[model samples]
Target: MSTDFTQEQESFATAVAAFCAREAGTREQRDALAEHGQHTHNQGLYDKMAELGWLGATIPEEYGGADGSVVDMCILLEQAAKGMAPIGGIGPTLITGAAYEKFGTASQKGAVLGGIVAGKSYSISMSEPEAGSDVGNLSCKAEKTEGGWLINGQKTWCSNAHFADRILLVARTGRSVAGGVTRQERGEGKHEGLTMFDVPADIDGLNIVGIGTMGGKEVNDLYFSDCLLPEDSVVGVEGQGWAQLMTGLNIERLILAAMMLGTAQRAFDDTLEFITQRKQFGRPVGTFQALRHRVADLATEIECGRLLVYHVARLVDENPTKLFPREASMAKLKLTETAKKVALEGMQMMGGYGYATEFDMEKHVRTTLVSSIYGGTNEIQRDIIGKTYGL
Candidate 1:
């Protein structure tokens, strides 16, 4: 399939790239921002993006969003990744915004979605200490109380929690294992008992402890100690969080795939430039057949990665009801793996220069490595894909 972007998409990407190049391209600036324990220090840049109507690209215009398409968001994300902008946590924020638009009460939508479009941050709290991949086993419990629900549990690996204004928390309200409970008995005719709560970040009992990561962003361990919320906090019908989360997962995987592809393309471009400039044996290194072949292979893989991601995005936009677990998994797995491979090959081709902090390749390596581990590991993606084949 042809992978070229449309004129509008290309224009959007060019705008994002130009913004990044002007505002966040220097090593010193990035390191300084990283040292402050901030994800991205350019709220000015973010605000500019928001002003350009890019922040809430996929949400409806009624909610102060751009009413853009998911493919548009992918284009922006790919551009950010290529620029190595510190906007890694943007996917979760956008996903939470979409979820609010989909399942939130009117008040919830007015508050959360409006704030997100205004460039306020948010996070999704799904992973716990024991519930990394097995989300159903989450120990975070939300029990009904006089007014609403009281949440008491801890969530780990929650990115952007430290700076988020709210968290889209998935808490278990009843006991039900996968395939073992009747949908009607629990509440309705689907996965039930699990509920999504819009918990404020500064709630009385909520605690956020920053955790260091290799990519210079800080994830957090969030403890919800009897954190209480009003009745309006629950998203959609009670006991339908699993299905809701499943719907969001498809978009989440596609976003990550786009980011991975962007990084891969960046790595390839950096390697190409380096090989063409650095001379070895009185000739540019890129003139060698071996390095040329390696670049060709990486370019081909990157093309495949882009196609897989865009195809999945198109499918999600075209048919939201049809389950695409395998397709999503395949896209996530291949893009992440390709990102790592491209980064490694880029570094190897650049030799000593690649290891220098002044060079972008080192940062690319670190960032791409972290990408593989987050948004579900490639190994887990394989397991999901295998199970789809009735394994």
Candidate 2:
């Protein structure tokens, strides 16, 4: 895979960097915008990105978006995260937008995609209390109703749901069919009867409660008790949610990998600044052999992560409709694991300061530590990659 950026891509990166510096250059600014985890973003800043066409980076031009490539979107996310910008909702919004553009009906696309370009964010609800990695087993049922579907179940870890305009929901609609046979007939029927829906957040019978987490108020638990969605809300064909989910997951993993790459870079840059200034034994701490070697290793590792992430981004751009499952999984696994390692090492190197909330190291640690678990656990990624190799 080629790892080089063209002049246009390079210019775009530069512009994003400048935007980050001006908007979210300080920890205090980020804290104020996030409001002690009560919110996932600064709406004002988010609107600015939309107005500047950054939020619509992945959207098609017909929907008032830039029609930019996946690689461009990756660059924008990397810069935003590296600068600690308060645009955490943008990733999910873009991912949700992609799914809508692909499978949504004309009206669904008009509402969701139009909102996305107009600076509205969305949340995705795939993981239920019982279905995280094994999403095919999701029990969130949506029964047929008079005018629509009556959904009744619980969805957990729904990020940005509290403030999002809409949700991309996956629920079980019927029985599973495995290899042209049912599970009761002695076949693997783990991935059937699933359907996708575009649920408005303010719909009656839908309740969202904030879930306190180490990563702040970034996620919530949702209860859908007779949540009524019109028949037109279904994104694609019923009983095809598994295939639809595969498409979204590819982009989701790539977006996460890009964010982690930026996060790793941020942690390394912060640690390097700390060691270069703090003196010990009458010299800068970075001058010590052990500390210097570790820094060098981390820098090299981050560079490798960058190449892997961008290579996957390029593949995605080249084949937008094709699912590069193996490559996307590899990128997600490598970057997330590397991010965790880099953050932990940076914390250890920073010693006391790293453990304090006053410093950004602790925040980076909190964020990167969960990267492995969210976009499907690193173990799952490894399993997927191995299977592609005929393991």
Candidate 3:
């Protein structure tokens, strides 16, 4: 079930694995970092990766990146997740980079990608209290002014916004043209009139409040009262944020898929390790037929997920302009669902140890549990995939 890779890619993955083993070697170390509010890797680890040119893995060489392919990024992310490396910041940064690369102005690209190569993180803010999966329904308004745009709205579930160097803020720019009525002014079928803005995290009137969650402080609610941005803050054309978002969603989903694949493998590996060592009935519990079969099934499923994810990554890399929505959605749906299944099964198999904080299985369970909910819920993914078939 493993994705086929060239010798160079394999070598790179091996190096990443070795790095993880050294930096995030044990569950205790990872837990300690997480306890200190580094839900993903700390800034030091990020800086190290940046120095190694891993942070700009997907950006082109002109922008200080290695000009690597998406497949390369998938390899890096999968290994990071498997080793429990605190590199969760990479995904959001990648998406933000993708957006800037495709639709941003020259200055925007220079600033954002330059920051990435310098180990700065970025996060996109699209989901509002009313938006979420229905991102087009977002009501965050950015009205045109003499100098630039005046932003005022609330965005929830904005992961990394609290610490991100810049927030890729998507807001309503024009009024919906339907029936000559402005949707933002009226509040229905509001898919148009959206624009993307690059706002610095420390901008005036921007307040990021961290939200408590079972997983930790991974997301936040951003309130913008009088946030103003210069004319150059817009990523692309005004009233085209939806198209811009669509352009990056494929990459975003693939990034999540890779993370989930690694997570599922880690859970399975942890469970295997636990069962082989913990004895029962005067023998190893892994010897039980039922448990053995379960492990085999999970292994097979994980391999399948890996193949699908890499396949999609390759397809997107081959045709960046084409929206392989079906393939992208399939990858997200499968890996997320499989990750959840593997974590839950690993927890059940390990019993008390799985539930204990000393073990990583419960943490895996918590993280994977939300995989199906984020990056456009699995339900939304399924609907997108189904629509591809003209269903």
Candidate 4:
């Protein structure tokens, strides 16, 4: 992977950094933008970004977007995250956008992608209480009806749903393959009968409940009780949601990896600043061989992660229609786990001050800890990568 950023890329990063710093540079500014201390999805700021054409980073030109490449999207996200901007909704939104661009009908694209470029957010309800890692095993059934599909099931960890205009929903549409085999009879019939639907967030019989965590009110649990939709709500073909989902993982994982890379850099930079200033026995603590070597090791790891990220990003960019499951998973795993290490190590190095809410290190810890878990756990990513090699 090329380590150089073009002049245009450099300028774009600078612009993003300036925007984040100007908009949410201070603790008070960030707190005010982040509702209830949540560091994700500040709609007010997101609208401002939309106005600036940044929210359309992933959408195509037909939807009033910039038609930017994956690398371009990564640049924007990385810079925003490095600046600690609270635009968490962008990640999930882009992941959802990728699906629509790939599998959505013209109307579906017009509604979702166009809305996204216009500052409207979206979410995906893939995981259930029972289908976190085993997404293929989801049981959220959507039965056929005269009007449309009648969805009835529960979905959990629907990220940013409360702030979204629509949710890219995946549900079961069949119980057997043309009366050939029942799901149980086939064993691990995780992929059959699955379908994707573009559901309005405020649709009747669909409920969105917040799930609170250290990250605040970001994710949600959605309950669908007889949620009726139009026949046109079906995205792409029925019973093909699994394949559509697989196609989008490259984007989803890369989006997350880019953000985490920025976070790791920020944590490392903050720690370096602190150790260089804080005195230990009449000298800067960072001057110590032990601390210096530790810092060096982390910086090296982050550098390696960055290379792997852009490498996979370029691969995806070169062939947007193709999949690089092994490389993308490796990028996701490397950046997320390395970010966790960087954040935790920074906190440990900062001692009491790091734990204090006054500093951003603690927040970095809170954010990075979850990166490895979401976007599929690091263990799952490892499995994906290993399976490619006949493991």
Candidate with the greatest lDDT versus the true structure: 4
Give the runs in model 2 whose Cα sits over 4 Å from its true position. Answer: 1-3, 36-38, 176-187
Name the candidate, 2 or 4, with the larger lDDT value: 4
Give the Cα-based TM-score of candidate 1 against the true structure: 0.92
Q: Ranking under lDDT, best-scoring first? A: 4, 3, 2, 1
**What RMSD value applies to candidate 4?**
1.6
Residues 172-219 of candidate 3 have per-residue lDDT tens digits of 887755577665558665667889999999999899999988777789
Candidate 1 lDDT over 275-371, as tens digits, reads 9999999999999999999999999999988888888888887886666899998988999899999999999999989998779898788878877
- The C-alpha lDDT values of all candidates are 0.82, 0.87, 0.88, 0.90
Q: What CA RMSD would candidate 2 show?
A: 2.3
Candidate 4, residues 256-347: lDDT per residue as tens digits?
99999999999999999999999989999899998899999999999999998888888998998899999999999999999999999999
The TM-score measured for candidate 2 stands at 0.96
Backbone clash count for every predicted candidate, in the order shown: 0, 0, 1, 0
**Higher-ranked by TM-score: 2 or 4:** 4
Clashing pairs in 3: 41-86
Tens-place lDDT digits, model 2, residues 1-391: 2358888988988898888888777777777888854465888988998898888877888888888888888999898889888887888888888888899988888888889889999988899887899877678999988999999999999989988999999888888456786662463576778888989899999999999989877999999998889988888999898888888777999999999999999999999999999898899999999999999899888899899889888887887788887999989999998889999999998899989988989988989998999979999999999999999
lDDT of 3: 0.88
Worst lDDT run of 10 residues, candidate 3, spans: 32-41
Cα RMSD (angstroms) for every candidate in the order listed? 3.4, 2.3, 1.6, 1.6
Q: Which of the two, 1 or 2, has more TM-score?
A: 2
